[model samples]
Target: MLFKREFKRNLRSLIIWSIIIAGIILLYLSIFPSMAKEQANMDNLMNAVPSGMQKAFGMDRLSLGTLLGFYGIEIHLMTTLLGSIFAALLASGIVAKEQNEKTAEFLLALPISRQTIIAQKGAAVAANVALFNLVIVAASLIGFQFSSAQTLSYKAFFLLELAVFMMHLTFAAVAFLFSAVARRTRSIVSMSLGLVFIMYFLSVVAGISDKLSWLKYVSPFKYADAAQILTEQSFRPLYAVVMAVVIIGCFFAAYGYYRNKDIVV
Candidate 1:
């Protein structure tokens, strides 16, 4: 019952985010043909760009003229950012809202344990993230169909999406941990967004110089890098394992914290 309620409560927001992300994908992809028309000029312009800038933006690894390459270089970052925000916002609010709204007492009066509550809420958040990614995948396929460039390997595309989903799951788990431990809900979004952007910046910095390359190990975006996925047509199994470990660790930590937390009315 709690799972159903949480799912219904978040359904509207999930739909809205899905629409916004899909729209962004469509908008950028629609421009691909026009961009491809000036591919030579754009290539020249990009070649003239500083090598560091090219590396930072993935312009050095992908051809902006090709459909898959264009998507990797242009659309991937937007989708990843927006998706992370959506996951963080949802995960951060799921548990903290009850405390912030002074409804935890009423919820605790229910027959369910806190563990069940967290599990249900976490499942809802995961379902929403999965749904959002599914929509984006469909939107991307449609966009590719309409564009003039030839379609790349669908296997590679799906692998890229899987990596992105893993990254989103990690962020959601982190937000869930924050929500479980937070005394107040007011700063949840701010904190989550700050963390996401910080990691993103670190990933970009890591790409710009070898000295900072170690930063990639800490950034989820590095594991989900579309440029690398596009170039290799596959993702590193080790990175995926690391992401899974992070997700499991965060989730267990959240459950442990929330289970022992005092519900102050």
Candidate 2:
């Protein structure tokens, strides 16, 4: 019942977000054909760009001439940032809103256990994020079909998609932990957005600065960098392990904290 309610409540927003993201994907990809025609000009232009900016944005590794290169550098950025924001916002509000909106009293008055509530809500979050990714995958395929003449590397494409999903899961898990411990939902949205962008900033700064390169290990974005993924054609096992650890640790910590938390009605 709780799972259904939460899923249904967020359904409209999910559809809207999916459409907006898909549209953006199509729109950006549509421009790729024209951009590819100007390949030499694009390369020369990129050559003039500061090396730091190129490194920060992965332009150094990806070219605008090829489909995968363009998608990896351009489309990948929008998808990861937007998808992370969506996941973070959705997860951050799911648990705390019960108390912040004064719904917890009625919810707790029912026979369900807190464990059940958390499980149901977590399921809903997973379902929503998964469904969103489904749309993204389809849209991306269609975009690739219409935007380029070259054959894309299916292995790299799917791997990048997997990375996007994993990135979403990481942010969702962290934001879920935040939701479980937070007292009010008032600042959750801002906090979630700030967290996502801060991690992104760290990733960019890490690439730009030799001294702070280690910061990439701490940023979730580095776990599945588009340039790194495209070049390696596989996910790094070490980064994959780190992301898994973070996800598991955050969920466990959230469950432990919420189970004993004193919710003020």
Listed in order, each prediction's TM-score against the native is 0.97, 0.97
Q: Write the per-residue lDDT of candidate 2 for residues 1-265, one digit (tens) a residue.
A: 9999999989998999999999999998888999999999999998999999899888999999999999988888889999999999899999999988899999888799888888788889989999999888999999987765687888988888887888898999999999999877768777888999999999999999989999999998988799989977998888888888887888888888888889999
Q: What range of 10 consecutive residues in model 1 has the weakest lDDT sum?
A: 144-153
For model 2, give the 10-residue run with minimal summed lDDT.
145-154
User: How many clashing pairs in candidate 2?
Assistant: 0
lDDT by residue for model 1 (28-61), tens: 9888889998999989988998998788778999
Global Cα lDDT for candidate 2 = 0.89
| Among all candidates shown, the one with the greatest lDDT | 1
Give the clash total for candidate 1: 0
